[model samples]
Target: MPKDQKFQKINFDLINNLIIIPIEINGEELTFVLDSGVSKPILFNLSDRDSLQINNVSEVTIRGLGDGEPMKALSSKGNVFKLGKVKNYNQDLYVVLDKEINFSTSLGIPVHGILGYDLFRDFKVEINYAARNIKLHNPDLYKHDPHSKSQTLRLSIERRKAYVEGTVLMENDEDIPVKLLVDTGSSDALWLFREPEKGLEIPEKNYEDYLGRGLSGDIFGKRTKVSGIKIGDFELKDAKAAFPYRESFGFIKNLGDRNGSVGGEILKRFNIIFDYARGQVTFKKNGNFRAPFQYNMAGIELQHNGLRYIAESIAGFNGVVKSEEGSFGNVQILLENKTRLSLVPEIIVSGIRAGSPAAEAGLQAGDVILAVNGKRIHRYKLQEVLKMLNEKEGKRVRVLIERYNKDLLFSFVLKKVF
Candidate 1:
C-alpha cells in the first residue's frame, strides 16, 4: 500500500478477453472492467442504488454503438473510488438506471461497471496476460527496464481512448496506414470503420453478422479477415476483424478521426504496459502471439453461469449418455468455502444467428449446453468453447443441451458462408 513502492500488484479476472478488476466504491466492494477505451468510470446494471451514497446525482442521456435508443443514465460527482489502498476522491461516474442488460451473466462474473482512462492517467499500468496480474506504478518514480526487449509505441490520446498508428493489408496487398484505437474492452481482433475519405471498405469475402452486444442493443456488422496488421516491427497475419455498419456507431461517429480499433483479441498476444502519463505503450509477445484469429462459425452465442451441479435425478446422464425421459435438472450450489470447490463452468445459449449451423440444427435461446463435441462444457472456458465452435469449416460439432428439463442432442458442421 505504500505510495513509494516500485509497483502495486493487483489480481484480475480474465473472462473472454475482458479484464475485470476488484475495487471499492463507497466502502462496498464491486467488480469493474479495466477499459482504456472509456474516458471516465461508469456504473451500471446495479439493481439497488439507494444503498450506495452517490453525490451530486443528475439525469443524463448517453449514446453508444447499436440499434437501440439513447440510454438514460445518472451522472454523479464526488464519489470515493478505492483501488487497493489507492483512493481517488471527487471522481465522476455515469450510473445507468435501466437494468434490462446485465453484463454479469455474459461475463460469468459480477461486473458492476467499467473503470477507464482516469485510472491510467494517475498511474502507469503493466498488464501481464499470462500471469493475470496488473502492476500499478507511480509515474514520477517508475522507470522502464533498460535491457527489456519490449517495443514501445507512441500513443495519441483522443477523448481518453488510446490510438496508435498501424498498417492494414488491403485486398490488393497494399499496406494502408491506419490509426487504430487500443480498445481492451472490445473482444474482436480489429474493427475498421468504413470511411469513404480513408478509402476503407468491406473486404470482398465478408459476411454480415452480429458483431457484439452493446450497451444500447445488438451491433450488426461485417466479419472478415485482413491479410495482416503491422504494429511496429511485428506483423500479424490473417487477423479476424469486424466492420460495424455506419448506422450502428450512433454518436461515436463524431468523436474522433480513427480508422479502426485494436481490441483485446489482438492485444492478448502481448504483455502490455500502458504508460499514459508518458504517452507511450509497451508490448512483448506471449506464447499465443502467433495464433491465427478465428470467428465463431457455429452461429450460437453463449453466456456463462457460475458454479452449478446437475440435480440428483439427472446425475445418471452426463451429456454423452442419451436420456430415456429426455428430462434433466440443474441445481445451483452455495459453498461456504468457494476456494475448496473446483469451479465447473456452465454456459447457456443466449442467441442464435438465423440460417447458421446452430440455428439449422434446432439450437435455440435458453438451452443449457451440457457438452460440445463429446467433451464436457465445464472442461473449457467460455473463450475456448467459442473458439472450438468457430474452428474449421466442414468440422462436425455435436452439442448436448438441457432445455426446459428435457435433454436434446443437436449436431452441425461449421461452414464458411462468405
Candidate 2:
C-alpha cells in the first residue's frame, strides 16, 4: 500500500461509552479498547479461542486504576500491529497472564487488549462517535478543515497521556477551573480526586458506590452530579460524576497538578479531533450532548461467564403435504426442522453495592442471570440489559438467576439516589 494521505475509516463497537476497535496482532484479529489515558498498549483476556504471537518478551508487573495488587505481565518489543492495511512494525506491548483481570466479562465482548498513545502520536485522529467511525489523517497532508464548526482547545501531553482543562461547577453552581485527564477508557462521566483544600470535594449528597475496575483492583467511590462542566463555549448541565477513593490511586503514581479525569461518559457527547503533534483537541456537539445522565439504577455490575450451548428447534423449508377431507378443500402441511444446539452467552452478576436496590432485593454475586424482566438474558446485549434496569426511577424490575442448581427470582423498584 502506498503512504496515502488518509487511513481506512474504521467502524468501532461502542459499549458502555468506551470505544472498542478491531486490530490485528501478528495477523490474529482481536478487539481492543482505544484508551487515551494509557501510554503503552496492554494485552490480556486471551482465551483459548484466540491465537497470538509475541517476540522479545520479558517479565514485568504493572498497576492501574484497580485497588488490587500489581498485575503480573510480560513485555514484548517485536510485534506487527495493523489497523486495516496500516501497519506498525515494532509495536511494544505488555501481556497480562492473570485470567482474573479479563475485561471481556465486564464489556460483554471478546476484548483482547487496549490500544493507546502509540496509535495517536503519529496522526491527526478524528472520531465521529455518533456515526461510530474513526479516521486517521496523515499529519503532513492533513489540514484543519476550513468549514469545521468545532472549537479548538489546548491539549496537555504529559507522561505520554492527555489532559484538558475545564471548569467544574461547585455546590453553589460557581464554576472553578480544574485540569482533567482525558480518559477514554473509563465509563464514568467525571472522576474528581478529593482536594477540599482546592475547593474540590465529594458532594454532600453522594452515595458510596463501586466506581469501576482499575488496573490494580476494583475502585470504590461516591456517585453524584456536578452542576455542570464547561469546556470552550459548551457547558453540560448536571453531568454525572464519581469521586474514587484515594486508596485506589496507587496504580497511578501521581495525580500531578490535575484534579481528576473526564471520561467517555462525557467525551462521547461530541465529535472530536486529537492533534497530538499540534498539542490541541477540538470538539463539536453531537446528538448525544443533551442526553440525560443515568446511573445503574439496579446497582448491579454484570460480566460474561463464557458460553453455554442449548438445543434450539428451527423451521425447515420442506413441509409435509396432506389432502383435505373434501376435494375442493385446501391442503394442510406440518413440518419442522431438526433440533440443534446453539452457543449463547452466559451472564452473571459480578458485583452489587451494599444497600442498593439489587442488594436490598437479595441479589448476590456469582448468580447466573437467566433472565431479566421475563426476557431471556441471551436475547439482549449487555448495554440493553443495563438500560432496562435504569429505565426510570420507580420502574419495577424482575430477575431470574440460577445458583447451586436452584433457580431463584428477585424483584426491585429502581430508586433515585441523588
lDDT value for model 2: 0.84
Least accurate stretch of 10 residues (summed lDDT) in model 1? Answer: 322-331
Residues 129-157, model 1: lDDT tens digits = 87989998877778888336679999877
Scored by TM-score, the top model is 2
What TM-score do all the candidates reach, one by one? Answer: 0.86, 0.91
Instruction: Kindly list the per-residue Cα lDDT of model 2 for residues 1-418, writing each as its tens digit.
Output: 2376455678998999999999999888888999998999999888744467899999997888777888789999989999987788998999988888777778777788889998889778899989999998877778887336679999989989999999999888777899999988888899998888888887888888888886677889889989999988889988899888888987556677988999998999999999999899999999999998978878898877767654545466344443433111223334355554445677788889788999999999999888889987666777777787779999999999999989999999999877
| Backbone clashes counted, model 1 | 0
User: How many Å off is the CA of 241 in candidate 1?
Assistant: 0.7
Residues forming the 10-long window of minimal summed lDDT in candidate 2 = 324-333
